[model samples]
Target chain A: MSLRLQARKLACERDDRWLFRGLDLDIRAGEIVRVEGPNGSGKTTLLKILSGQLADYHGELFWNEAPMRRSRKAFLANLLYLGHSPGVKAALTPLENLAWYQALAGEPDDAAARLEALASVGLVGFEEVPAGQLSAGQQRRVALARLTLIPRPLWVLDEPFTAIDRDGVVALEARLSAHARQGGCVLVTTHHALAASSALRRIRLGQGGDDAGA
Target chain B: MPGPDASPVSEQQAGVACREPREGTAVAVRATLKRDLVLMLRRRSEVLNPLVFFALVITLFPIGISPDPALLASIAPGLLWVAALLAALLSLDSLFRSDFEDGSLEQLLLSPQPLPALVLAKVAVHWLLTGLPLALMAPVLGIMLSLPAGSYAVLALSLALGSASLSLIGAIGAALIVGLSRGGVLLSLLVLPLYIPVLIFGAGAVQAAILGAGVAAHLAILGALLAVALMFAPWAIAASLRISING
Candidate 1:
């Protein structure tokens, strides 16, 4: 199974300001690509564009050698994106959140699977507790549990480590590396460094090094 | 790197790939509908607020205008219709606010399923909780307003049909303004204008019934409006939601 994501001459403007221009990237399976930049440097914006969320841009994106627009459904089906927010409902428990999320992703509903996912994320006793009562880190964990439930080829994560503690960060890094080893690709933007022993690539936005040649 | 044995990749893939049934648009709609209902149920106040507002507004009309049955009866149809329209509008601001704030809206946008189907589901739940209840409650309020004897049934039926269009059209405005911090007033401004046609026909149906005129034409127009909304409003709402979230 071979998969590739390529972007050419991408440019984006926000609020009459040029966030980035002439950016290009290529990602392949079994590789981890990290987007590095300072605040207001368009790291999150670029991630959103790659994930097909933000469209106000000038660029061409190809997934597996096909235009992203022409094959959006297939591309999206093969992609999993986790944005800066945890995206868990406060009124729902972790298990319920996972169930709805899986259903949205077109995954089969499995109560036992959801329970096990929550447990794997160290949310054992809190499975039934509403997410509103969970701490910031615990809520983030609830969202992260999705990584275990589905095995999409590409993951675009924005600030996945925002509220995570040291242990959570280490565990998440291991998961990223493992995913890469399993022939999946990951695109992540975070201030914290990932301790993954894999073929890591970096694209530093806003600097001259906007293009990370594969 | 973690050893292959320690990695959950194989187990996770097996779990994900070995499912019996794959979800589709129908599943997406059901999931969104169920989740929204559960959220609204927990915050029962949201479901009840518009109904109470509809009742309160109806109650004030008789006292403010005049308590005489003739005076109240003459104006009851328009009064009830207008009050219900405003009440439904009041609840529109909340349709997307919580979801947007909690970041679940982003998830919905990113879902592989068609956004229009999911949006239709959300609006369906809104109608069920707010619009349908208001329609059911109109008869009780109709008696209080001293509406003509034969018009009570027409009032309830008109509202049931008219509110469906209201929910659909109002959802577009709600989606457009969801990103703004103070969108309550702007939402009304955007939606109320579009509500004119619905109001004219909805009130007309009851008026015709009271006057002993044929109510068929008004009811037909209202149903036609709802059909048009059901066909087009979902797409508009989905597009507006995208703009609000991406902009």
Candidate 2:
């Protein structure tokens, strides 16, 4: 498997506290790498830097061996990022939400594909219900449904297991492994024990615990 | 531009089989426009509040100032312009607030499409919902203010053209303060000064048209301001959003 993303000398500090200095990272295809760290440990920050969202850091990120800035368009095109908030519009129905996301990703708006994705995420009967009316776990599912809607190489998910029910968690864990087995890389941050994941490779952020004592 | 099945565009040279499929900018722009329109439409109260404010402020002038037709006509141009400008400003706070709060703005930032183009599409929808309605509703309120006979059309035309620039300019301030909880007051402080030239020319257009002095100069200047704003504000708004999101 080829290396999809590599970070060299990544030094990031937030609020005058060094989250990490000279950190290096590498992820190859068919690997589900988990980022473990406490609150404010800069797990999200590191993901943002790699995904090309946050630039308040010192690092060189290469996608397929090309500098991220020089190839930002292609990098973003292949990246699928799921943040803490579900990224679902409260007013729009699940169908509308997924359709808009697909369109923004520059995919053809296929009603069948969106419906099928929603069903796979277990939002079958509630397709037309406004997302604001859905429960928190359901709302997160609406965001997770994006995974099935489009095919992307790199998935940077922050706390994907939060508020998810047992069934949803089991299904999601399986999906992550399935995706990695298909030659996609999954970089996730979660406290949920991925006990069933044989494909998991974890990198814990040590600065989070050290900075607390300082 | 690549079609629906956008072949993975790799900056790297030959033999790289990348599989990132992207839709064209036009499609992305259309989706953003449609999604925003639907969102605003569903929140009908937010959409209508500005127009109601416009009418209420215009309604207050006769009772608060003077009911005399002659007196009202003399001051109507400036009053109408100022009221419309405030109403447009009232809607600006919510423009990026919801997107920022719900994390949709982050997704927008991460899109393969250029940020400025996507931002422009959103501002277009804002203009359509807020600016266009205010312009159309002004003529009715103009009658209340005893605006001159022929200048009613000019009032609508001036506002329709000028408010486009207002939405564009106001959006930059909206984006800058989107991360703040109490941005409504600061938004006005940041945007009001920039709105001066637009207010001057917009109000001036109707006043000139009312006098039958040929409003071409005033209207032309408003158009020029709109042109300048159109060219620059989207990029500014995009940059501000990135800063706000990162911080």
Candidate 3:
């Protein structure tokens, strides 16, 4: 069940500007890697590349000693990605959002478990309310509920802490650490410093003097 | 926290074994179709806007051009088809916009299910809500336009078949420009050219039926176009989506 993700000499350019070049990363089972970078430093772009969502970059990625492209389905099935947006449909309720997430992940129907997961996220009374009516943080919480609902080995989360309060951050850190303790790997990008006891690896982008003018 | 070596191999394998039996392709398709339908259902205006636009556009042509029944009936076949095509186009911009805005499109892209199958599901829902309704409502608009009596059924039938192809083909254009901020005009520009064949055959079906000729040929051609679009449009749409998102 051992899993490894490795990238070599990755490079990306956007709008005639070099965001990052000569970037490399490696992650194994039971690890949490945080990508740190300044604004416009391509942190989200890097995460997208790692998740196979973006292909314009120049790089080679290997998963479990095989080319990532060779077994995309197998790789994606074991991966969970949460982008900057909460991905909640405003027209839908929290329960419906979680249900759709579960279904898309190929998980079986379990209404009882979904309700418990929503409740654990502090959405007890807001399950049936339209997400458009919820606060920004509450909508973010609705997206965070997926952490407890699905059990994928690799998680590529982009700013999972945005709009979340202090207590929410603490609970989320605990959840990430728990995932690592269970031999799962997470590749996350967030501005907020994680307060987990587990060892955290860091990848800093745009360190060189690449942006001199404008 | 436990180190990497703390978990026993047997327990870890058990966890892997637990998640192996995923839902099949059919289930995945049904889930996507159901999710989109449910979301669109909640936003009732999205479904009704195009239908209303179709009826309004049909109603305007008579008052705008002339009240003469002979002129209206003579042009009704082309007018109805054109109006229906424009109505379908009205909804195409939104087929992927809301999902892309809310980030659900990224989830759909990341899903392990076949991309083409999932995209086909989305197009199916679009046609079901927009294209199918416009087809069913065409006869009423036809009556308003004084369409020849013999061609009423053919008008609806041709629209039902033709709009399926329109939705499928229009989806490709929609997917291509979904990332752009001002894609409405460009969507029409890209899709309208491809719609010519469907338009000719669809109106031709009604025209042939009005003249008491064998309309089977025109209807068959429309069906064939749908069959071809069904086979190939999904892949084109899936590719266009990838390009749009990755850009």
Could you say which candidate leads in TM-score? 1
* Higher-TM-score candidate of 1 and 2: 1
Indicate the residue-level lDDT of B116 in model 2.
Answer: 96
Instruction: Give one digit per residue, the lDDT tens place, for model 2 in A61-157.
Output: 8888989888788788788899988899999999999988998888788999899779878888999999999999999999998887877778999
The candidate, 1 or 2, that scores higher on DockQ is 1
lDDT of 3 by residue, A138-203 (tens): 999998888667768888999999998888887777777767767788889999988655557787
Candidate 3 C-alpha lDDT tens digits along B59-142? 999999998999999899999999999999999999999899999899989988888999999999999999999999999999
Candidate 2 docking category?
acceptable
DockQ of 3: 0.38
CAPRI rating of model 1: acceptable
Name the lDDT of candidate 3: 0.86
In the order shown, the candidates' Cα RMSDs to the true structure are 2.4, 5.1, 3.7
Which CAPRI quality tier does the interface of model 3 achieve?
acceptable
Q: Once model 2 is optimally superposed onto the true structure by TM-score, how far is the C-alpha of residue B128 displaced, in angstroms?
A: 0.6
On a 0 to 100 scale, what is the lDDT of residue B4 in model 1? Answer: 41
What TM-score would candidate 3 get against the native? 0.94
Local accuracy by lDDT, each model: 0.86, 0.87, 0.86
